[model samples]
Structure formats: C-alpha cells, structure tokens
Target: MTQLALCVMLVSEIGCNRDGLVICYVVIPPPDQQWGIKLPNDTWTGMMGQLDRQEVDMALGPFTMTPQRASVCDFSVPLHHENFAIITPRPKLQSDVLGFIKPFTVQVWLLILTSLLSVATAMGCVVWAEGKIFRHSEKNIVARAFLWVFCTVTQESSHWLPKKDGSRIIVSFWLLASLVFMSSYSGILTAMLTLPRVTVTIDSLADLVSQSALPWRLETGAAILTYLKESKEEVHQKAYRNMGPTIYALLRERQAVAEGKIAVICDETSMKKAMDLDFSTTGQCHLYIAQGKVMTNAMMSLAFRKNSKYLVQANHRVRILLESGLWHKWIGKQVANSSHCLRHPRLDRREGIQPLNLESFTGPVLILLTGATVSLLVFLCEHLSHLYVQPPKSTA
Candidate 1:
C-alpha cells in the first residue's frame, strides 16, 4: 500500500502473480508518474489525467480520498487510510520565565483579583452598615477586609472576623470559592513545578498557526495544497494564504522545520518516510510529528479507470492486503530498510513537570525582584518629596 514495489503485489492480485497465477493483461505506466489530479474540466492533466483520458487502466501510489478524484476515477477499496499530519521541530522545554502565571490565564488572574476586591468591598459595606447596630471599632475596616481576603486566599488563618450575620455570610461563600480556586491553582502549579510538565507542544493546526512566524507549507503541487485551498474552514484558508511557494527541491526549507523555522504538512506516508530518513541519516529524530491530525478518514488506495472490468478483482486484492496484515508487513519492512523512528513520541514525555529546579522558581523570583525594585523606587520618591517640601513660613 505504501511502497512502489508493493504495487507489484497489488498488480499480481488484480490478475497475475508469481504464486503460479496466470496473467490476462500487461501493465503499463503513464508518461508522467508524478502528475497531480486536476479538476476534470479545468484543462489540467496529471497521473489522474491519464486515468481520466483512458490512457492508463489504473494509477498506483498513495492518494487521499476526495470527492473530486472519485468523480474522475474509481478508487479501489481503501488499502489503508491515513490522515494528514505535520512535521515540526521538536519542542524543547520553554523558558519558565512566566512560570508562576502560566497555571492561570490573564483573565483568570484578573478575575481572582476582582473577586478578592469585590468580596472585601462587600464585607466592608456590611461592617459599615452594622457599625450603628453593634459596638465595634470602625477604623480602617476597608483595609482590614482586604487583608482578610488576601489571607484567606493564601490559606492563612485570619485572627479576626466580623461578628455580623451579613458579613459572615459573604465571608463564608468567599471561603468556599477561595478553597476551590486555591486547590486548582495549587494542583496545577505544583504539577507544573514538581512534575515534568512539557510545554503544551504543537498538537494541532491551530497551535501551529498560533506561532506568528511559524507558517506551514507543503511541497508545491501536493494534493494537500488543493485541500487547503478549497477548504471552507478559516484556519485552513488562512494557512493556504500564508504559505509560500515552496517546492520539494527546497530540502533546506524542510530542514528549517527541524530547526523550528517552519512547519511542513504531509500525508501519513510521506511524513513517515521523512521521519525514517531523518532517523537513518542522523541516528536521531530531528523532526517532531505533531500529535494532531489535519484530516481524518482519508483513504490511501490505487485508482482505476471507471467501469474497468478488473475493478472487482482489484478491490478483492486490496481487502486481502489490509485484512491479512501483509500491507503493514510490507510497510514495516520498507521502513526498517531506512530507519525506525517511532510513529510518535511517548505521550508522557511531555508531562512538563520535572524535579524542582532553580529554573522552576523563575516566575516567583522575578515577581519578588519586581516587588523589591518598586519598593526601592517608592522609598526614594518618598525621601525626595520630603527634601523638596517648602517650609511653613507663609503660615507663620
């Protein structure tokens, strides 16, 4: 199903074979082997063009199942199915510079701060309303309420609580909410710091596009380009627009992907071959296959001229290769001839958490340094203001 040599097996299965089977017809290849299927009436031609014009009985090699291709020629029952995948640079551990805030999003942090302020304001209002009915100190109740909220969020036991029903209710509900917020934050942050939390690797097309500079491209005239161009999805349309005119000859561009310059999208077979070639050439996996599939339920099959008498025999042969697992065996044998790069990396490798290290504390340490710098600036500004103050001579 994958290798050109395997096509011999398929050809044999259609009519003849070395297993004492006799041939009824001879096989022939169209002049252009690397032709892409053009829209039927678009006045374009390729491998599928040969089939369309009745120049070839069947076309071999991996091809994605699409409605357009189906209308032009009949595909045998899928020898195998493959989804589009991406090859990008292996993601290294991202810098933990913003590690502290990574656990919560900006909106989340803002909401948390808002919640604290809102609860404190509510409690302060309750205290003020109750001040007339009860006998308690009323000085700096706002500041005190703020302190209580802060301490509660930090899980610090507050030494005092307002002794009023309304204020107590506000505090009680906030306590429950804060418990959930703290537990989630703690669990996430702890997992981030104590366990190896791999940066959310590029797992999808959206993730790849999120990197402003990391545009994705495939070989010129690839079937995928047609898919991208005609796709109605916004991201797919955007990708097609942003892509450059890169051809397969631009091996350097693909190498750039290994260096994290850009990403390349390919059908499953091409991607597997590229990975295997990398493993064979360098003895290390330099490319990373994204965890997400670009397309699903894509069939890889041999194409036959419509209403060809051999169609039923080809379908039967394809089913045999698939059901018997011989197709996978041939694929594996071909893959081993080059190198064995696992289909994808181990999922646990990106759990992101590792043993606590100095790097893990980068976010907290940066916050502390920022606070200290601000405190120093405030101290300087205060003394400078004192020195510049005019004497009270005018009042005297």
Candidate 2:
C-alpha cells in the first residue's frame, strides 16, 4: 500500500503517465536476504538475487537499507524508517472478585494479617493484666480485644475502654498505626476497583526471552532475525538464542499467536497485517504491539539493481514523498479503514462507568453468606448444649 501510494504521487509529480515513464514493481516473499551470509544453494532467492540477475527494474517493499545490501545494490532514499516490534497476544483482564486483592502480593497480605494478630494479642494481654491488678470489670477478654483491634483498623469507634495507663498507651499507638494502614489500603483499593489492572504479558525483548513458557519464534527469512543474531548486545543475542525453531511464514505465526501458543518478533507492517486479520476473523483484537521498538534506528528503501538508470529519479521522488509526509498519511488512511475492534481494543473500551455486576461482588457476598451460616450453626449448638447441661424446669 505504501509503495503504491508513493508511485501514484511520483507519477503526478513527474508529469508523466504511469504506463510510459514510471512502472511499479512488487517483490513478494521478500528474499529475507541480508548482507553478511551466503546461502548454500547456487541459485539466489529474493529481490537481491533478482536485482543481481537484472530481472526486475525496481524492487518495492519494506526492503531495509543495510551496509551489506547497500554495498551490492543501489538504494533509493529511505521511504520509511521503522523499528522492529514484538507482537504478542493481549493479556486477559482478570474478573475474579478476589482480584481486588491482587495489588498486594500474598506475602504482603500475610504480613498485614500477622501484624493485626500481634496487635490484638498484645492488647488482650495488656487488658487482662490491667483487669487482674486494678479490679476493673472485664468480660470476654479475647473477643473484646479482637473486636477493638478490628474497629481500630477499620477506623470505627469501639465501646471497649482501657483503664490502665499502660493499656491506654498501647491502644493509642495501635490507633495511630491502624490509621495509616487503613488510609493507604482504602486509597489503593479504590483506585484498583475503579480502574481495572491488566498485566503486560510481553513488554520487551527481554521479557519475551525470560518467560520461556510462551516459546517465541521469528518468521523464516525475516531480516529482524538476522539483525538479532548478528547484534552484539548480550540481551539481543540471548533473545535470539531463546527463540524457538524458526517458522517459515507469517500466517503460521499469526495462527499460533491467536491460539495462544507462541509470540512473533516482526516489523510493524507485518504485525499490523496479522492483527487486522485476527480482529476481522474473531471480531476481537487479541494482539498487542509491545511498548518499545527493538531495532531503534532502521530505515527501509527501494532496492534497485547495481548501476540502474532509474536510481537518481527514484531517490529524488522517494525523498520528496517522505519530506511531504505522504507516507505517514497513507498509513493512517489504511489503519482508519480497519475494523473498530482493531482500532479500539476491547480491554481499552471504557464507554462509561459500568454498573457493578454480580461477579464484581462475588468475594464479599460469599464471605457474608458463609459468616451468616456459621453463626446460625453455632447458635443451634450452644442451645443444645445448654439444654443437656441444665435440666428443664418441671411443670409440676
């Protein structure tokens, strides 16, 4: 699409009909040929080979400009500058009611519980000692202690009173601590419930390499793979080494990604094409383009055979098109024509404040129901025990 738009613009600018002066040539299954290595086969493949053999006038596509390829074939001025991107399935949004507790890890929650228990135990011991020494009226030491602790943590007033100076001092400190804890928890929990959190399954090349379960792979003959293998950086080298067996086609990689089997490292154009197709078929956009570009500074240009007569003209026209921003405009128009699912991902769609559903309150509702059932059972057991221990009054 980019090449076609540029060709049209070129013809208009040059004041010549498309048939006589300028012709658009396309190279499919991009030769995936890079400068450094020589394939084992005698016959060469891709645009480089065709250009070397003088079979085509010009090869159009996202043919990147590299030192090795530039040495052999003359390149037009860069048509587009693109950084390699990693495409992975969008992480699913968690809907479990207990998901509200996910902001804090299990260890953090355990620590909070331990602190609560310790504070309650300390308060109970202090209250019992004060009542024993001072003769204060005290009842249900353990239950009252825990109730006081719960009320303090919840920032609610408690009826229990501590008479001794030591007990009062402990309570005062506990209140201050509870205030801080409760305030922070409330603020964080509210933000979590209001704006749902979604985990990023894959953010960068390192992330993809570290999580080996997903088993990432590159398309066969992709220039990015060559770049990764040849890169001197340890991170890029490790990422390339971690890649699973090379998949020969982009369509296969797209299918694997849609099925949640694998992730593919590809250029933006290929990633967009796969995402568009995935959205069209499933009516949902499950793919996500990761945060940053892998190859920071990469430029793509048209490849012409060595010493081709059209090099100067093609270079001038491509430079003009790029300078005028026609390339970006054409890309925007293409993306605009895609489906809404692709343009606006489902996870990002927040039309308005959605009403809380039953699922949203599942954890709290279950806790309420369980507590009620247990309380009823305990009441029945206590009543039965009382009847057995004390004989009922005779009507005599």
Candidate 3:
C-alpha cells in the first residue's frame, strides 16, 4: 500500500472507522544518515523530500514541518522541533558574554555600513585616479600610462611601462598614493570580514577544534566528523589515528555537551537542546581555527517528476503539519527543562528566566503590513473592474 493511503488507513483503523482502501508505494528516507539520506534519483532533501517524491513511504525522522514545506508534502504530525545553535570551544570570557552580544552583535546596520564604506572607498580611488591631476599630467597619453596606474593601484607590476622620463614622475607618485590608500582600504575590509568569522566560530565544528584541541565525540560517518578525520589524517597525525570512536562514557550519547565531554555533536538545533538539557557546554565552545576554515549547512527537498497528484498531496500535508503547532511544541520540550540550571545558580542567570525572541518578529511584521497594503489595492481593483463591467446598474 502507498505510504500515504497506508498512513490514512492506519489512522482511520485506530480511530475505529472503516474507510475504502487505496494502496500505494511510497519512498521512505532511511534513518541511517544525519541530514536526509539520498534516494535513487541521487538527490536528498531530508526525509520530507524523500516522501514527496514517493521514494519512501514517508519520512519519519525529526523533519521540520515548515508551512512552506507543507505546501509541498505532508509531515506526520511533527515528530520533533528544535532551534539552531552553534557549538564552539568554551570562550575565555564569563558565561554571560553570549547574552551581551546576542542583544547588539553585528546586525543589518553594520553590514550596510561596511558595504557603503567599501564601495565608496573603491569608487573614490577610481575617481581620484581618473581626475585632472593624473589625466592632465605632461606624460605621453599612451595606453601604457593607464595600465600602469591601474596595476600600481591594485598592487600589481606594470611590465609594459619602462622607467622613462615622463613615466617616472607620474608612476612614482601614483604608485605611492595607491599603496597608502590600498593598504588602508584592505585593513578595513579584512577587519569587517574577520569580525563575523570570529563571532560565528561557534557555528562550525572545525572552528571549535581549532580553538580547542581536545578530542570531540561524533557519530560514525557524520559529514562533519568525516571531514575532520580526513583532514587530520592528511597531516599524518598518530594520536587521532584511532582515539577510539566514542567520547568519555559519562557524556550523553547524542548530546554534544554534558558533565564530562568537552564538545557536542548533531546539527545547530541540537546545540540549543544541549543548553535546554541544562548542559553546561555553552560559553565554553569556540571556533576551531582563525584562518583558512570553511563550513556549510544542509539543504535538500522532495523530488517530483514534473506535475503529479502525489506531489500536490505531499505539499498539502506539509502545510497542515506546520500550521498544527506541533513544531513549536517540539522546540518547547527541548528547552523547557534544564538540569544544569537547577545545579548551578550562576548558569541560570546567564540563561535568564526571560523568554527569548527566536524569530526576530520585526521583519515578518513589516512584511505582513506591506502585503496587506498590496492585497487591499488588488481587491479594490477587482471590485472596480466588476462594477465597470456591469454597465451602469438598471440605467436601462
């Protein structure tokens, strides 16, 4: 029987109802992998995608039943829900550091400022180079002059322009100016980019490793763990060769942080769970390295063969799941209880009793207001169109 019909039938039978039978095959995602496993089509979209494509009967993992996804596939009355968190090596500062930064860290205003500064500086330099002083200089108006100026400003050598009389004066001063401005500009750009990297270090496992060189536990074959082991092996390190698969037995198996283990495993949401569990890993985790590090999040969805009824049904299911309040309930469970909070008074203060505003309601509220304005305009237009089409009611 199709997983969809089977599901309906199961639900129906359990509820003491006799319904018509409709059997259909469904493709299910195996729970073997962390992010959704791949189907025969060689695509992975987590469990939901597998089910939508009929690759699997239905995805039963802790798939997020987002409203957007519901428009594509049905989620089975939300299995689990959690918030995203980054785990890094513990910071050197007091535990309240995150509490402080969370309020006013690098925000949209900061990004906009940096972008404006970079663009303005780049344009200013370009304009200065093309200005009257350099343009009206008594040097020969050769293409080589332009190339020389451009190359010098960008810190590249100009092989075509020799050290001739006219080229000497212009080249010397221009090169000097470019060096000073370029150096200053570069410093600012570097600082802007590195600030976020440093702050978001907790977001990546490698960043944690670089910051703290302690052994961390990870499930066998996990992508993050695999990447770490591969990189470590490439350097021919003997200690990491086989430091045993598990971490200190005292730590929770799925939990990244606990009483004994120094690190945590699982996706971003799981990190939040650790804090919710009253685990004390927060404030300690830090970025693994300061340079040449990289990490990416998981992205996948259900597959479909063009337009199909199954696809439509799957999307509808996703919508219902998201709107049903199951996802939020799941998240509440993960964070509501904290063992650590009860044991340590100071830790509770950092976490605080005040509720967290997870979604940043400002953006969505503005968007909703804008949408309502547009929708009102559309409705007005439709009403006017209907009146115009009715040919002056009863004038005849």
Please state every model's RMSD to the true fold in angstroms.
5.7, 6.5, 29.2
lDDT, model 3, position 275: 49
lDDT of 1: 0.74
Total backbone collisions for each predicted model: 11, 0, 39
- Off-target runs (Cα >4 Å) in candidate 3 are 1-56, 62-207, 221-256, 279-311, 338-396
lDDT for residue 339 in candidate 3, whole number 0-100:
32
Reference-based TM-score of each model: 0.68, 0.71, 0.32
**Which has the greatest TM-score?**
2
Better of 1 and 2 by lDDT: 1
C-alpha-based local distance difference test score of model 3: 0.42
Q: In model 2, which regions exceed 4 Å deviation? A: 1-37, 40-44, 96-147, 154-160, 164-166, 172-180, 242-256, 273-284, 337-347, 350-396
Q: Which ten residues in a row have the lowest lDDT in candidate 3?
A: 285-294
Question: What is the RMSD, in Å, between candidate 1 and the native fold over all Cα?
Answer: 5.7
Which order, best to worst by lDDT? 1, 2, 3
lDDT of each residue in 1-396, candidate 2, tens digit only = 333345445545533433566454444434554322224664445666666667776665556687766765788787777777787777765456786676678997788789889988998899888888888768898898888888887788888867789878888888888888777878887777777657776788878877877888776655676688889999899988888887755555787787778887766766676766676677777777777678866887777778988778766766677788877776665554234534323257556876767887888898899999999999999999998888778997
Per-residue error at 255 for model 2, in Å?
Answer: 5.3
Q: List runs of model 1 lying over 4 Å from the truth.
A: 1-5, 12-33, 39-45, 49-57, 65-74, 102-188, 200-202, 206-211, 249-256, 276-293, 304-316, 332-359, 391-396
CA lDDT of each candidate?
0.74, 0.71, 0.42
